[model samples]
Target chain A: MTYTGHLQLEASERYGKSVLSDAYYNGVFKISRPTYTDENLPLVQLIHVGGGYVDGDTYLTEIHVKNMAKLAVTTQASTKVYKTPHKQVMQRALYKLEANTELHMKQDPLIAYKDARFTQETEVHMDQSASFFFTDSVTPGWSKEGTLFPFTCITSKLKVYQNGRLVIFDHLRLKPDEDLMQLLQLEGNTHVGSLFFIHSEVTVEWIQKLRDYLASFCDDQYGVSLLQIPGVCLRILAKRTSLIEKIFAAVEEFIHSTIYNRSAISWRK
Target chain B: MAMTNALFPILQLSDSQFPSGAFSHSFGLETYISNGTINSSASFRKVLEIFLANQFVYTDGLACRLAYEGLEIGNLEQLWQLDQSLYALGMARETREGNRRIGDRFVKIVSTLYPNQVFDQYNMELKNKNVFGHSALVFAIVSKHLGIERETAISSYGFATASSLVQNAVRGVPLGQTEGQKILVDIQPLLTDIVNRIMLLDETEFGIGAPGLEIAQMQHEAIDVRLFMS
Candidate 1:
């Protein structure tokens, strides 16, 4: 069966923040505070809900960050794409960050089981003075001793506009069966994540700070470099899925406290 | 009879000694070497092979053919479209900049020596707008101006670039001279097949995927210090 889910967040002066549901079976996922947060700060909460299957072909997830509001969105558990006897599963995420707002978006690794076929497309747009930090980690699913996922292709495009001018445009497409792990490819990396942080007013000093913070979580081989433009991009490759996820979480919290001025989110036990 | 002599211009245009600043740029090889991903001569050969088969085939090879045909028909719009497509396909800033630099150098040299109106016009357009003048486009313009056959010019240029890369690998990877020559000899047959494949390409089949190369190129941008401009 096909599944489709959409979640929209709108800020209300009276309600603090409201999660609006358009369709799909919704579930709330909790994110715990990182061990590093200061004792005085409150832990943030993330509400995750997914609607049931529609036709098994297409699924949609929409996240909206309202003006001047901050939100941290993450998955409660690693999402598994089961092998279908017949067709592939397709999903898309549309994230909108309004002016003066921030979204610390991260997700658990996606494991594609053997014979499973999946495609994901993500589009993000951030307004002027807005900040966005997002990470997507993916891993090959469990298969028989030698077999792996039949095919997995994920394409993502992130566009940042400030005052109607295009500031940053990032597009990525990944296909695992094409031998992405080959030396000339990802250099035999099984787990990889692309972390991007964009803010027009970000200074060189700030970039260095971010780089140092990212460097502190040293488990895998990762590289952090400043874009000639205003943002910073980090690409990390690791063997263990859990280590990568932890590093991602730490980076997310660092960005939240320093850039967004938001409290850390406490993960659900 | 005419075809045999026609091949000379193709060879000359694609020659590594053409002085279009091709040797100065290792095309991210310097970065890879510094990072230790490419330590030996053998590893360099592997990297170049993957680069040629995966990236140059789809990108520069296809661009060369399209630009050659575009110039032959005097289709500026088609050429512009091809240029835009190349820009979009290039994900790394340094790689994109390297292409423009090489293209500009080619146009500057050719405009003074060859003095072709088409070359001058294209160069002017490139300067006025931020149009990316990639090496493939410039090679096409010069090859066509020199009255060379399209397939031969494209293939020869592609092969020459691959050879230069191998030579750079020899130096950077510290490979023996004989080993470098061996690598070149090994790649000749592959170049022939690539040329044939490039010839059969259609515009609709443009922009084939090569993500690893894109990532490597992107990674090159963040590399702290590098010998090659790219």
Candidate 2:
């Protein structure tokens, strides 16, 4: 079965926020907030109910951030994808931000059990004044023997559109049997995460600052660089998923404290 | 006689000593090593295999073929379009710059000896900042000018690059000279397969699933101390 949900947020006031959907399925819940209180940055929570079915297969979530607004979206719990006898689970998230708006979205790490296949695609559109920060974390699943799957594949793509034109495109395909952890590949990193931030007026100095900030996490193998366009991309290849998640959390918090905080100070009062 | 002569142009263009500065760039190998992903020769060998199988087969090989065929029919627009598409497909700044740098160097070398309208025009465009002079595209243009067949040119380019990579691995991994040649020989069959695959490729298949290499190349750019120009 296929399920689809769409959420849109338009900020009315400085701290006014709206909840688009907070629905729960067998064990999986679809929680989204289009707007949030900048004053407190309330944490929206979604819990997985025991005995509930947790099938990420054929699931879709879409989010739209309107013009001149700010929104931060995240999940309350680490998502677990249970293995099934017949099919692999699939999940996709889409984000759209209008001109002069900002959207910061990060998902808690996902753990996929043995024999699980997952495919994800993220599409982002940013106007001249628009800004975006997003990340996705994934972990391998275990088999019936309590061992990880001998073979697993994950495919993901991130497409960015600026001024109605395609600007940056990123894609990753991983297969365990193919020796993906080799140096020429993911370099033996079990956990891989990508962070993309796009802003037209962003300068090289700003990118260097962000890079230095991300580099402060000393435990993981990470690299940050500027894309061909006016944007910055950070890729982390680490031995542990938790490390990557912590780094992502830290980055999101930094963005919040710096960018959002400055805006709040200027326009809030 | 025609076939033998056809192979000659390929030989010259594919020579590692062509002085295009390809040897100076590890194309992210240095970064991989510093990151500890490539600790020994065995690991480096594995990485090279994956790189040849995934990246070179799909991207540079295809670009060489298209540019060669485009030049054969005097399709400048097609060549320009291919260059633009390559630039767009190259996500990393260093990788894109590497392509342009090698392209410009190749054109400079060819313009001194061959001196044709096509070369002049492309060189002029590159000078005016109208288009990025990508290495594969320039190879196509020069190989066509030298009267080499499209298949020979593309295959030779592929083989030569694979050989160069093995050579670089030899130095980076510090493999013995004999061991390096052995690695090249072992990969010969795979190179042939890749070349054949390149010929059969469609344009839509370009730039498919190369994030590892892209990320590595991007990282190579910021590597504080590096031996490669990439």
Candidate 3:
């Protein structure tokens, strides 16, 4: 038997300020009090009410933003998945960004403990004019004997559609069977971070500058990919979670200040 | 279609003179070569193994297997979706375009050389822009039409891929011809191993590979001077 928790949130701009006009969550899920740090953008924190994820735990999340609206979403804490000898923790998120809308999703790292398995998929449909920013990380959790990759496997997938045409699709699976430390794989890194940003304002020049900026961090291995559509994805493989997050945070700040032409918003961790 | 005459076409198709346009792309080799991670033939062979094991086995190899089965069952929709998934899963734009170009070129060349209904249908889909054809899928269909054995088709396909990279390394990494052949010979068993692994993979296990290669391929796009497209 499996129970599926669901969260639906919608936001729109009213009187020049974004507000959470509609929100619903049931079955072991809740949202923290709306935090307004940008004075107009509402930060919605997803709170898993029934504690950490376990075997057979599944969740569905839907986020929508009306035309001209701006919204930010993050998790209250790290997603911890314990031993799942039988079933894997499955999570799905759907996003709909109307024309001229903006959505930023910066969530905490997912920790896959010993003998755990986790899979997450995100699908997004947005108009050509909409702007979307999302970042995620995967980190190994605790183990009795202190193994680096004790989890069974961790899988993530993202598919993006602009104007009903699939433009970006990224699929990643990390398992112990393959040597993740190889030059063609993780390059001796344990933590993985990814950033996906889609905006009409993206350009070749911007991507070049961003790559130059990231190249300064010689200790961490990073790659920035320009989407066929108007966006970019940056993936960083680092030895520490802080290293990964630092790269992501720097890129995020660059996007905000350089691309969005505003000061970066503090996640307020 | 296996009228004891299939060997000639398979050998010709796998030959380096086929003009498959694989020479124009090094996948992610440009990045590694420029960054000094793949200067020697030895290092190139090591990365090639990783490529065979991590990326190639899961993506193109699996797609070829699936396309073969799909054709046997007369399932065209699955092939269409397979093409789309291949395109979508290609996070790096250059690698995506490179493979797509090679796939489309295969469709064009094979249609004239050995006409088949599956090729016609795939050509139609390509014309409609409904699917982004892949070389692996196209070759599988062609192999089926030619009555080539599954293992032969897979092995020859893998060989062509490996051969092209080695050939590219001859110019990019500047390795000797004998050195290139050594790398090719070295990877033969690994290719067989990859095929064995691909046979056991489930549909859900597709697209499982290292992000490091993808990142390297992505970085190739930003390099100031690039010999290959990918």
Candidate 4:
């Protein structure tokens, strides 16, 4: 439709439980009913009805978690970016979490097909006490000519601010037209992924333990870094997207079992 | 006369022996060294080339470009925003703090040594805790105040950065000084080319960092008994 898509979700705490207070979607965005899991954490899934992200298409998503509320959002499947000849497909996600709130976004891999151009910017603003977790992955989509790196461009930028101070900013600009591998120093690897977990309790000891734990499952291609603001980011470059996903799964498990003293609910394919 | 006026200060600031405290940080190289990812001079050079093209051109190089532009427009707010953005883009905690430390020291020493208004104003912000200082931004301001050309300032900064890292690699990788000098000499052409590209780069092209290098820098923090501060 050469138009912009929109989605807004609001969640709050009531009676010691989190609830989806308000929701809105238009232009090919659909949300499944909120499902509450252990600890009153509501899981919401976003469905893209537009088939695939087309050229010149833009999507805007705004999510708010009110005081002490908890929310988790996921995608049903991988987001496919089709050819964007005329212009690049753009997506902007804005998230706000009030004091002591928690928000998690587990996005599926972005598969960019041949000649595809995609740019996504995600910004999160949270209180000092709030907790946020985010996951993103990128994979080269189908190529008729059987090329390895077919996507024209894939750019993902994320900025997280706590209490109105910029803390974490990560920008990944991948262009197959350029020397993509050498440009990013990926060491001949293709798939790329990142997980950012921001919480006050994230300490050096905890991150080191997580790093040591992941060292068995993950190859030397992956790295875990602590943000100065009490958070950790794990980034990996791999030839297979599955490896990245597996590492992230391990990280989630570690975080839940060690820090939260709970089991992470399995995310089935 | 003007060229010499600018050149001497640029050289003084760019010298590794200067009191900028940049030598204390490796940013991410130490992690790779510990992991044996950068054991040889060739491996170090490959990583360095990638870093120069992929990360430094956008982050530090762009900061200098933007800082110079901000100075031209006489906008202190622009410089402030640049400093904040540079600080924010550093995902590694140790690397981020290390940059802040070097930049803080550079500004403090230069402002006191040169006695310029813009430098003092910028230093005041840092002293007053208004903004986290970044070396690239400070380098640009110091260069501008010293009447150094923008391209020269950027090239000098790039050269200085490469040489300092080369020194670190030589020490950490246990390579000889000859190898360090060779690596430094080899990157001069790259320094020229990167400076040119950064000059024409738009602000939108700024803050680009590779996941691999960033991870290395991040992991450097956890290495027990690390050699570098970053």
Candidate 1 per-residue lDDT, tens place, B116-169, comes to 777777777788864667777777876787777788777777787887787677
lDDT of 1 at B37: 74
Question: What TM-score, over all chains together, does every model reach?
Answer: 0.74, 0.76, 0.94, 0.95
Query: Which candidate order results from sorting by lDDT in descending order?
Result: 3, 4, 2, 1
Compared with the true structure, model 1 gives a TM-score of 0.74
- For A54-145, candidate 2 gives per-residue lDDT tens digits of 34446555666665556666665666666545665556666677767766666666676665566667777678678877777667655657
Greater-TM-score candidate between 1 and 3: 3
Best candidate (score: DockQ)? 3
Cα lDDT of candidate 4 equals: 0.85
Which pairs of residues have clashing backbones in candidate 3? none
Interface RMSD of each: 4.1, 2.3, 1.4, 1.9
Model 4 bad stretches (over 4 Å)? A1-3, A266-269, B1-4
- How would you encode candidate 3's per-residue C-alpha lDDT over B78-144 as one tens digit per residue? 8998898888777677888898898889889978788888888999999999987788886798788
Give Cα distance to truth, residue B79, candidate 3, Å.
2.2
> lDDT of each prediction vs. the true structure?
0.64, 0.66, 0.86, 0.85
Better of 1 and 4 by TM-score: 4
Which CAPRI tier for candidate 1? acceptable
| Candidate 3 Cα RMSD (Å) | 2.2
- Candidate 3 is graded, for docking, as medium
RMSD of each: 5.7, 5.6, 2.2, 2.1
lDDT of 3 at B28: 85
Worst 10 residues of 2 chain B by lDDT: B1-10
In model 4 chain A, the worst 10-residue window by lDDT is A178-187
